[model samples]
Structures are given as C-alpha cells and as structure tokens.
Target chain A: MDVIAGLGQGFLVALDPINLLYCFIGVFIGTLVGVLPGIGPVSAMSLLLPVTLSGTPESGIIMMAGIYYGSMYGGSTTAVLVNIPGEAASVVTCIDGHEMAKRGRAGPALGIAALGSFVAGTFSIVALMLVAPALSRVAVAFGPPEYFSLMVLGLSILSFLTQGSMAKALLMAAVGVVIGLIGLDQINAMPRLTFDRLELVDGIGLIPVVMGLFGVAEILTNIEQQIRRDIVQSRIGSLWPSKEDLKASAGPVARGTVLGFLLGILPGGGAVISSFASYAIEKKLSRTPERFGKGAIEGVAGPESANNAAAGGAFIPLMTLGIPPNVVMALLLGAFVIHGLQPGPLMMSQNPQIFWGIVASMYVGNIMLLVLNMPLIGMWVQVLKAPYKILFPLILMFCIVGVFASGNAVFDVFVMIGTGVLGYLMRKFGYEAAPLVLAFVLGPMLENNLRKSLILSEGTFDIFVVRPISLVCLLIAAALLIAPLLPALRKKREKVALDATD
Target chain B: MMLRRAEFWGGLFWLAIGAFVAWQGWLLELGTLREPGSGFVFFWLGLIIVAFATSIAIGGLRGEGPLLGDLWRGARWRNVLLVVLALIAFGFMFERLGFVICSLALLLFLMTVVDPVRPTISIPVSLIAAVGVWYVLEKMLLVQLPKGTWVEDFIPF
Candidate 1:
C-alpha cells in the first residue's frame, strides 16, 4: 500500500506539464545522441548539466535520467542497422544484430531489440523500486567505517574490472583523487593545491573538468580519425517481429533480464559484461551454437535486453549508497550534489519526491522510447548518415558556451580546454577516464569517512575490521585487488618457459 | 633513449608532479595518525603515484611501450594544433570580444580552416548556432553572457 501510494504520488509529479515536457526533451536528445556516433550520454549529460541549473531539481534530474536510459534504447538502432554500436553497451548487439540486418531481417531485429529493451527496462525499474528501498534500509545502519570500507570496495571493484591494466587504473584513480584535492580541504579550511589562486580556493568545478574530459576530449579524438559508416542497403521488412520471432526471443529476454540486473549492480563493466554474458549464455543454451554469429534472433534479443536492464541496474548503487558504478553515474552524482542533495540512504526518506519521481519518470520514459524507436527508426538511420564534420564543431561550441555560462567565469572555460587536452592524451595512451572521473567525485567522501572512522577508533585501523559490514567490504576489496594477479603470474611463468626454450 | 617513448616521458612527468604534491603535503605537515591533517591523504596518494610512475617508467625503459611518435602516427597534428590555438584564443577573447563574436569566429575557423567546409554552409550554420545559443541562454534562461565591450556601446539593443 505504501509503495503504491508512493508510486502514485511520483506519477502525479512526473506527469506535471513542465516535467513531462522536459522528460520528452531529455529522452529525445538522449535517443539522438545514442543514434549518432562520437557523442555519448556522458558528454551529452556534462554539456547539459549547467543548463539544468535553471530548472527545478525534479525536472532537471528527470531529463538527465531520461537521457541515461533513452540512450540505451537508441544505441541498438545503429548496432542493428549499420554494425556500429551507438554506445559501449550496444557493442554486443552489433555482432548478431548486424548479421540479422545482412540477412534483410533488419526490421525484425530492430523490433525484437526494442521490445526486449522495453521488457527489460520495465523489469529493472520494478526491481529497482523493490530492491533500492530495502538496500537503503540496510545502508541506514552503516557507520563511517562501513561507509569507508564500502567506498574502498567500490573503487577496488571499479579498478579491478576495468578493461586495462589494474595498476594503471589504480594510478588514474589516485590522480583523480589528487585533482579533487585541488580546492580547500573539506576538514580544515587550509588549501592543499590551490597555489593561492582565489579561483581555486572554492575548488575545481566538476562541470569544467567533466566538460573538458568528456565533451571536448571526445571532439579532439573524433577529429583525429576519419568518420566512416556503412548503412544497410537492403529494405527493412517490417516494424514488428513475427509471432515465432517473439516466441524464440521469450526465454532469452527473461534470462537476460535476470542476468543483466545482477551484473549491472556491480561497480564497473556491468552493462558491457552483462550484454556479453547474455550473448554467451544464449549461445551456450542454443542447440545450434554455430548459428550465433551468423544471424541468431536470440543474440539480438538477449544482449539488447541485458544492456537495457544493466543500465537500469547501474542506478541502484548510486541511489542507495551514493557510489557511482561508472562515469555517467559519477556525472549524475555531480548533478545530485549540484542540487545540494546527497544521494545516500537518507535520500529516500529526506527527498522522496526526487527519488520516487525519478523512478516513476523512468517508466514513462520507457514507453516514450518504445513509441519513438518503433516509428522513428528510419529517421534515426538517416540522422546517422550526417557527417561528423558538422556535428563535432557544434559539440565543441556547446562545450565552450556551456562551461563559460556555468559560473560566468572565463577561467573555467580555460580549465575545460586544458583538461580536454589532458583527456585526449590520456585516451591515446590507453588510459580510461572513467576511473579518474568516478574517483574524483568519490574522493572527498572517501577521505571524510576515512578520517571519521580513524577518529572514532583513535586511528587503530581495527574499527574497519571490527565492524562486520566493513570487514566484509574490505575482504571483497582485498579479493578484487589480489584476484587478477593469479592469472598474470601464471602467464609470466608460461612466458619464462617459452623464452627458455627459444 | 627511454625519453623517446611517450609512456616513459609521460611517466616521468607524472612522477615530477607527484613529488611536487608530496613536497607540498610535507610542508603542510602530516599530523599524527589519530588526528590527521589536511595533507595526509595527498601525501600518501602522491607517494602511491610516484610508485606507479616509477613502474611505468621502468616498463617504458625496457621498450615495452609504443614510441612517442606512435601517438601521432595518423593524427592531423596541424588541425589539432589549430583547434587548440583557436580554443585558447577563444578563452582569452571570450570576455573581451563577447560570446557571440568569439564563438562565431571559433566555429568558422574550425569548420573552414581546420577541416575546410564550404563557406556558404559554414557561415550560416555558425551564425545560427552562435546566435541561437546566445539568445536561448541570455533571453530564455536569463543567464548573462558577455556582450562585447565594443558591441555593447555600438548596439544598445
């Protein structure tokens, strides 16, 4: 009864004329950015963060959340049509989705992807609504030591699961924390790295850093490579999947929803891993495993559903624990801070409107996506054909203007440009920005809790282990840190043997 | 020889930065464990950074990474340089020449010079985007953007 009542109230708020309009705009832009290459949800969200300042918190966050999930729906369009993933999560969709397109089953592929995404998106929201509240209840009991350990666990998981050398990822995270330490120390008023600049005293703005790192950096990288895409030349047969097509996808959709929901709750690589895992699961489960890469409807259905579900699942840690699992969630965390709200356990109790409203709007946004994707698939295909030359300049212009307008400080714009160059170089050197951004946002919180825990126990370091939850978190972090070394050590030994033979 | 590799130089650069941060932290005084000061976290982090950089640099010295030139193998450095310069120029001139003029010029330069698009299309598209964004931010959102010092006196709209 209470949940239903909360949901009812949330729907009322989400359906408000202004909220509805912004939600539409958010999902619409999200879909466009998703369909277009070289522009991702992170860049789009960062570019629009300052603009959201003018609106109510609910509407602003509603739009941002819409962009987050709406992009999931739109990412599949390009993957199915042109074999190009519109976003990272859609990378798995390209394998079999494109094969289906090559077989002239593009329409059915798109339709199944859309339908599966809708089912998974809705499923995840229901799951989030049920699970997040219970998690929050548990999180409410967490002390400073527990929170500190949890943060450690979260960052460890992120660095461990990131697709590169864990050492490099950890190094990036440390660097990010340093960047976050540029302003006045949160505990003491003393400035750590400001160099006595009055501008730096207040701290580096998240907007400028994000705008540079994600927005402008993306443009610089895009400019370096020639933009080329090949669209499917064959006719798209039908918008709806056949009954047998639906029947074939039913099991995959169900399996993917559960698989994705579980994986997405992890700190890093959730969506990518989930989608790939879903594909793998579907293939292993299939009678004809060899048919997977050629043109299996199960492949399209499972990964698409898994990815969408994963996107929804990624929101849980952010909402309940205030720990962002990925960079986009980090930006969203920044948005929450910008609104002067902390996104921890108390958020549900303290800001029920924001919590429930965002949850309810996701439902509305999913319906909107289904409608948009089904009919506007052709339009999205056409939009993908637009030259990158035109889009990059426009994106750059938005970055410049957005950063400048955020604080009416031209200094911030310069900072953005500086960071953008750094971001570009980092990417070129195979360093990921995700860990850096997430760590930067989590840095202050991690330190504050760490100090608080230390103070509580007079710096003995046993408080973390004494607390059951904290002990569990630290154990997990230790495992994550040590887990990758086993395989690496084995490989090194194998290499030594090979060298000896040579 | 290792300096010829991007990873090596990059590692060394970060090492220097880490040392500087650590020195700053030391100057700030690392308090007792029970009552940590503002610099404690940074000091430890800086040390960690130095450790990582050392490994990276050592790895680079063993010729385990790509050459410095490999980073720019197919990159259009001229365009990249021009774009960076344009951005820096825009940042310097943003407050002086105003958002409208500065952005329009930057867009035009990027479109026509850096990558070369047709003048007719680039000019109009740049004009609309620059002006349209300024209008939305200024008029609709009620956010104040810099109107040029010269333009403000001449055009009193």
Candidate 2:
C-alpha cells in the first residue's frame, strides 16, 4: 500500500513538463554515449554535471539518474553487434553476443538483450520500490560500528572479487584508502600529505581524478586502435526472437535476474561482477556446455538480465543508506546533495516528493530507454559510420579541453596527461584499472565511517559483533574472503587464474 | 623467453614505481590518529603497493604465463608515441598558447600522425571541429574557455 502511494507521488514528479524534457534528453544523450566506445555512463554523467546543475534540483537529479540506467540498455547494442563493449558492464555480452553475430543469428542476440534488459529493468524498479524502505528500516538501527563493519565488508568483497591477482586488488584497494585519506583531515585541520601546496589543502578533486583515470585514460587507450567492425549483418531478419530462443532464455534470464538482483545489493560486486557471474552460471547450467559461447541466446539473455537487475538492485544501498556502493552511485549521491535531498531514511518521510519523484521518473526513464533503443537500433548502427580517424581526434581533444576547462589550471591538464599515460599502460599490462577507480571513490567514505565507528566505540572492537546486522555483514565478508582459500574453491580459482594469465 | 622482455621489464618498472612512491611517502610528515594525517595513509599504502609489485615481479620471473610477444602482435608503437608526445606537448603549451590554439594544434597533430587519413580531409575537419567545439562550449554552454592566442585579440568568445 505504501509502495503504491509513494509511486503515486512519483508520478506527479515525473509528469512535470520540464522534468519530462530532461528525462527525454537524459536518455537521448545516454544512448549517444552508449553508442560510442570509451565513453561510459560515469564519464557521460560527470561531463554533463556542470550543465545539469543550472536547473532545479529535481530536473538535474532526474536527468542524471536517467543517464545512469538508460546507458545500460544502450551499452549492449555494441556488445551484441560489433563485439566492442560500449561500457565495462557490457563486456561479458561480447563473449557470446558477437558469436551470435558471426553465425548469422545477430537478430536473436540483439533481440534477447533488448528484451531481457527491459524486463529486468522494470522488475528491478518494482523491487526497488518494495525493498529500499525495508533496507532503510534495517539501516536505521546501524551506528558507527555497523557502518565501519559494513565498509570493511565492502572492501573485503572488492579485494576478493576484483579481476586480477588477489595481491594487486588488495594493494590497489589499500592505495585507494590511502588516497582517500588525502587533503585536510576531517577530524582535525592538520595537513597530512599536502606537500606544502595550497590545492592539496582540500586534497584531490574527485571529478578530476575520476575523469582522468577512467575518462581521459579510456579515450587514450581506444583512440589509437579504433577499428570498425561491420555491425549490420547481410541478412538481418525478424527482430522478434523465436519461441525456442525465448524458452531457452526464459530460465537463464530468470536465474540471472534473481542472481544479479541479489548480488547487486552487495557492495563492490554490483552490476559488473553480477554480469560476469551470470555468464559463468549460465554456462555451468547449460545442457550443452560446448554450445555456451557459440551464439547461445541464453548467453546474451542471462548476462543482459543480470546486469540490468543489478542496476536496479544497486539503488538498495544508495537509498537505504547515504553510502554509494559504486562510482555511478557516488555520482548519484552528488546529484542528491545537489537537489537538497539527503539520501537516507529521512528522504522517504521528509521529501517524499523528491524521493518518489526520482523513482517514478526512473520508470519513465526505463520506458524511454526501451522505446529509444529498439526502433533506433538502425540509427545507432549509423553511429559507427563516424570515421574513427575523425571521431577520435575530436574526442581526445575534448578530453584534453574538458580537463583544462574544469579548473583552467595547468596542473589539472598535467594530471590528466599523467593518468592517460598510466591508464594506457595499465590497459596494456593486463591490469584492470576499474577496480582501482572504484576503490578510489569509495575509500574516503569507508575511512570516515571507520574512524567514526572506532571513536564512538572508544576503541572497543566488539561493537561490530554486538550489532546483529554488522555481524552478518562481517561474517559474510569473512566467509567470502576465506572461501576462496579452501581447497575446492582454490582449484577452480587456480584454473581461472592460469587461463587468464595465459 | 627473453623475447617477451616487455613483460619482464614492465614488471621491473612497476617495482621501481612502487619504490619511488614509497620513498615519496617517507619524505612526508604523517599526521597522528584521531585526525590521522594524509601522509600516514599514503605511506602505508605505498608500502602495500610495493609488496604487491614485488609479488608481480616474482611471478614474471617464474614465467607464470604468456610473454609480452603474444600480447604485442597488434600493438602499434608509432601511433602510441605520437599520441604521448602530443599530450606532453599539450600540457606544457596549455597555459602558454591558450586552450583553443594549443588544443586544436594537438588535435590536428593527432589526426595527421596517428591515422592514415589525408590532411586534405583531416586538417579542415580538425579545424572546424576545434572552432565548432570551442564556439558551442563558450557560446551555448556558457563555459568560460581559455582566450587562446589566435582568438584572444578580437573574437575571444
């Protein structure tokens, strides 16, 4: 009843003409970005933030939110067609999606991806409406100890699941924690690593570092080798899937939806990890495992559903607690603050208009994305027509100019250049930089909560165990960390490790 | 095999970087707890990075996997070098020549050098893209861009 009432309020927010306009614009821009390589939703959101801020808080937040989930639908387009993942989450799609493309079944692959995303996205939002408040109620009981324990759990999951050597992920996560500790110490005014620079007083800018590593870096890596694969197959047929395809995909997509939704609620392993996990699970469950990677419709269907479900599932943490589970969520947190709405339990009761409005707008946004992505598939394919020789120089130049324009400071440009170089090398070296970037954003929040928890408990470590919720999070995280070390899990891990290294 | 020297050398290079960052930490004044300082986190994190760097180096030495040769087949050094040099030049010239002129020049250089596209096509496109992007950013977007050397005199916008 409450969910229905809150959704009713959301409709009022979504229908406003100005809000609707921005929602349309957000999904439009999101598709454009999703169509392009190297410009993920995070970069698109951050780049447009300055422009979006000029509007009323609702417009800005709604539009920014639109860009976030809308891109998920758009990302799989390229993954299914040309095998180039439009964003990181869509990477798993290419493994089977492109195989389908190769075997003249491109239509089915894209059809399933589009349909699966739509279903998962809608279901997830409904789940969001139902689950968020319940989680918030549970969250309200948490204190500093619980928050600290929760962060530890988050970091531990990242350390364990991050796609590289365990040691590297741990090291990068630690570095992220350290980087978060930069600027003025929040507890006291003492400078720690400012190096006597005035700019260091505020520490590092989130916008700049994130833009540099992920945005600028991505552009540099991609521009050099912008190969254009033929996305449109010669004999493209019916857009709708066959009954066999649907039946085969139904079970996998259902399993993926459940798995991704569950995993999405967990910090650190949200959308991307869920997408990968879904692929592995679908493969494991397949009757003909040998057919798993070779144009299997379930391959595209399951991961697409999982990732979309994860996108919906991600709202659980952001709405329930003020904490953002990932970088995209972090950007959304900034949007919430911009809108004069704090994202916590208070948000539901205090600014039901804002809270419900954003939720309602997302429904509008999801419909808008589905409507935009399907018929426009032909138009999006034309995006590939923009010659890389022309497109890259312009995009790369924009990156250069964008970094400089943000502050008009030479140092920032230098930082972008350094990150570009670092990012390129990291890509070349087979090291994943996304985990580092994610850790970098989450590190500060974890630190503040950790310190607060410790100070509140007066250094009594038992605070975590005393709280039932925190205890559950800690136990889960601990089990995850230890489980990989057990002989059975280790054997599987070693095989994956060996294959990946080769 | 030593033919995959890039990976072995790359591993060593990262190890050096870990060491350098660790040294930078040592020079800073780590703040105390209750307001634990910035340097404190960096110092410890640097140590942790070095630990991992050492592990990677050991792995490389043990020949744990594929060599750089396998990965380097499609790699293009000319394009890589051109882009890197352009970026470094962009950074140094960003403030002096202004964002428009320096950035456009950088873009033009990249377009000409990296891809096999003709300058007849590339040059005008890059210039138009530069001028067009600058105009939209400054005029429509209301973003205050650098008044570059070329445009700073009369048509600054």
Candidate 3:
C-alpha cells in the first residue's frame, strides 16, 4: 500500500537470481546493440520477445525494460567514440562528445555521461514511484468516451510531429488502422478481412509486423550503403571527471533531468525534443556559448541526462493509463498483453509484484550499467569493430527464428516479409513507421470505445463535445491537425503578397 | 507526367486501397449512429484515408518530386532480390526440408551468393550458426521448430 513497502517487495522480486540474470543479459545485449550502429533496442527486444515467453512474466518484463534504458546508456559510447549515434536519442551527444574525443578528453566526457545517466535514471524511478500510483488513481475514473478522445489526441500528436509530410504520416496511420481491422470483428465475431484464411481470424500478428518493419527493414536499408566506420584513434584518458568538470556539469545535469522527465510524459517525440531542448537551454544559459561545439562538458552532460531520464519517464503513461507514449512503450504494452496482464489503474492494485518489481529493477539496472560501461568501455569499442556483413546474417537468422518459434506459423513469416518490403518503401519515401505502429496498436481500442460511447449517448453525435474531458481532447486533436497547416498557409499568403507587389 | 513521380504513384496506390476498404465497409453495412456496427469505424477510416491520399496526389501533380526510379538509386537490387528469394525459399521449405537443412542452405546462400564469402569460411560458419540456433530454440527454449518431414524420416533424430 505504501511506496516503501511496495518497493521492498519489488526488490525481493528483482533480487531473485533468475530475474537478475535476465536483467544483466538485457543490459549487456542493449549495450552491445547500442554501441553498434545499425541495430537498435526495438529490434533487440522484438527478437528476444519470444525467448522471454519461456521465462516468468517478471523476468521477461525485467529483461525488456532493461534493454530499453540500457540502450540509453550504451548509445553515448558510439557517439563519443565514432561520432555515429547508436540511436536517435544519442544524436545530440555526438555534437560535444565526439569533439571531446578529438581533444583527448573522451574518457571524462564518457564518464560524465554515465554518471549523469545514473543520477537521472535513479531520479526518474523515484519520480515514477511517486507519480504513477496517483496518476493511475485518476485514470480509474475514465470511461470509454475519455479513452476514445485520448487515443484520438495521441494519434494526432504522433502524426503531426512525425518527420516529413504530415499528410503522408496521417495516411500511414489510416493504413495501419485498416490493417489492424483484419481479424474477426470484436463485437459480432465475424471475420472482416480474413479472406477465408484461418490465420487472419486471429489478426495480423504483432510480433511478425514489428520484426519485419523494424528489424528486416533496417537491415535492408543498411545494406544499401557500404558499411564503414572510423574509430577514434586517440588514447582514452582517465575515466574520472575532475572536480572542476563535475561542478561545471552539475547544473546542466539537474536541469536536463527535470526537463526530460516533464517532456517524456507527453505523447510524441518527447525524448528527442527534450534532448534538443536541453542542449538549447544549456547553450543559452552558458556564459561561453562559443565553447559549446568545441568539447564542452555541459553539452555532453545535459543531453545524456535528459535522454536517459526521458526513457524512464516514458513508462508512466503506459503503466498508469494504459497508453504508450512512444513505440518502445508500445512494444512493452504488447509484452504485457502477451503475459495476460492488462496495464491500467487496476494493474498497480492487482499485480503489485510485477508493477513494483520492474520499478525496483531500474535501480539495479542503472547501477549495473555504470559498472558495465565504465570498466568495459574498451570491450564495447571492440564490439563496434565486428563487421556488418557478418553481423547482418546472424541478425537475419534471429529474425526468422524468433518469428517462427513465437507463432509456429509460416504465414506469419510471409506477413513479416511483406511488411518488411512495405516498410522499406515507406522509409525510402520518407514516411515514418512510428505513427503507423502506434496507430495500429491503438486501433481496436479506439474503435471499441467509439462504439461504446455512441451507444451510451443513444446515437447523438453530441456525446463527444458534451463531455468536458472528451471535448478538451478533441479540441487538442483539432489544434494539432490544423497546426501543421498554418505554416504552409502563411507561406502561400506571403507568396501571394510578394507576387502582387511585383 | 505526374505518375512518373514516386509520390504520385504511392498516393494512387493508397487511394486504390482506401477505395477498396470503403467498398468493403459499405457492403458490411454501415450501421446507424445510435449503435455503431463493426463496419462503421472502417467506413470512416477509409474515407479519411481517401481524403489524405487525394491531397497527397494533388501535391504530386505539381511534378516537383523525386522520380520513382530514385527509390532504388543506391540499392544493390541483385543482393536484395537474392535475400528475399532466400527467405521465401526458406519459409517454403521449412517444414519439408526441416529447420537444419533449410537454414543451413539459406545461410550458405547469403554468405556465398548474395555477399560472397569463400566456401571454406561460409561452410563451417553456416553449419555452426544453423545448428547452434536450432539447439537453442528447439532444445533449450522448447520451441517446436520443424524437424523436416522427409529428413526426419531418414535421420530419425
């Protein structure tokens, strides 16, 4: 009932030898993929999803969660050493981190990043412990209408912020919803898009789609370009930050933790936006703004802390409200559903061990990451030297085996291949897969809620606008939809004015 | 001329898909607003898709987009095609040829044909990886990977 008691029980679960082993494996693999350029946590998690099926739910979830945050720690390594960001969250780290590496301060830069990540990660877990229960209490009051509105707002924000054309992104979301409609109708139990195939009745398998889209598509994209990386040749100096360096970085790290935690609660692009925002804030606050691009410790400290904190904060919505704020959370949501556990307000009350065990594991995982990364930095660098040609075939094997073993259906394999090709084309055309995946996951819930709300209102279209929370969500969705168009409309009006003057 | 652009073609493809879904939803009978039917959401989603695709098509009509050919500009089509074919063949023969033989062949082809490592290296590596993965999945994880219909009859392992 109390936070302390819950955490005490959680530590008991997390400390169990099996869960600890899985956590270590997760973070270790996370760091490996995070150091390597092409593969990411999403692919790693998806590949391991089936394997975790054999383990207890606590161990399975602990492993997956470890991969999510562990990658955040490992991403900085490549950014500091090779100037290639292992993940999108690490992009900002490349700016000052690589510069520090060039200046022979790579060790301190990396040391500060790990230290900052540990502090922010632990801070976020404490924050999560404090905040999640309260939020779930509030979320318990929500009805179907509120859920419908929330999903609408979530999808709109996701599509609006996705890189490239908003129209294209929205179109992809629509496509995803359509694809999700393939299974037997939830209400009547009649197949909608099965086309007489029995497998379609169960719907398109999520594992196959994810593995195909993120895993296979990535490999296809990477092989298009020649694989080459230039490792930083200079000696990595001492792995400790000096007193002056720590003092200089403390302020940025604190600010980044607060900013990242707040931003990570939002629906779309939170981690990325927070990292960039933290960098901008630090640069603005700096007396020596000119020093930012040239090996400034603050640059490395702020964004690294922000991204790690953001990863932790992103778990809140999924845990409390049953809404995933990002793609990684979406996969975790799938994992929860696979384990026959529904994550919502009731989850905290019903499954305290699972809820708190994962929370406690973050504490263990963060400490493990610090220990793993600091002494084993050279080993991670050695992992980066593994050739892409050799690595890819192994990755491909994992994808195939993972999918086949999970479902025991060859049809799923075909689905993966088809989606993989579609994913590849989508990437080449500049359409992002995040919105699509998120929309697909949310589609069934959205439709079910919409129908329920309509039935409650007795066919009146006024139900959505009549409810205050629903009205606010719809209004926000409308704003996000129109927000992207304003800039384009303004540009057209400006062009018209210039033409008239000419 | 607009159709020469990748965006235009993509938009058209989505438009066709939208139209088809809308037609299917209609046939499923779009229920009244009071108690929505299964088709009600699909119908509206289809319409929304159509609207978005139409707008994309209009933008593409300006003919200021990358050509369709640009999609494969730097791709090694030969390698890509080989990998796809290998996967399809593997999936096709998974149960018939068994996990070990099919996976080994797939790896050998990828290493030797698509990317072209020497046989001396590709042979042992493929054998180890294929057998190693089978042991892990089937034996350790207790997943039921296919044991090959024909090959199992002979080897009986």
| Candidate 2 CAPRI grade | acceptable
Please, what is the whole-model Cα lDDT of each candidate in the order they appear?
Answer: 0.86, 0.75, 0.86
lDDT of 1 by residue, A288-347 (tens): 999988999999999999988998999999999888888888888888888898998988
Pairs of residues at least 3 apart in sequence or in different chains that clash in candidate 2: A192-B38
lDDT of 2 by residue, B40-68 (tens): 55566677777777776777777764677
DockQ measured for candidate 1:
0.74
Local error of candidate 2 at A37, Å? 2.7
Model 2 ranges off by over 4 Å: A223-228, A284-291, A337-342, A494-502, B1-43, B65-74, B149-151
Give the docking tier of candidate 1.
medium
Interface RMSD of each candidate, angstroms, one decimal: 1.1, 3.0, 1.2
B127-151 per-residue lDDT for model 3 (tens digits): 9999999888878889898888877
In candidate 1, residue A216 scores what lDDT?
Answer: 82
Per-residue lDDT over A45-78 for candidate 2, one digit per residue giving the tens place of the 0 to 100 score: 8766666656877788788878877788788888
Pairs clashing within candidate 1? none
Put down candidate 3 lDDT per residue, A415-451, tens digits, no spaces. Answer: 8888888888788876778888888888888888889
Q: Fnat of each prediction?
A: 0.63, 0.51, 0.64
Q: Pick the candidate with the highest DockQ.
A: 1
For each candidate, what's the DockQ?
0.74, 0.46, 0.72
- How accurate locally is residue A130 in candidate 3, as Cα lDDT from 0 to 100? 98
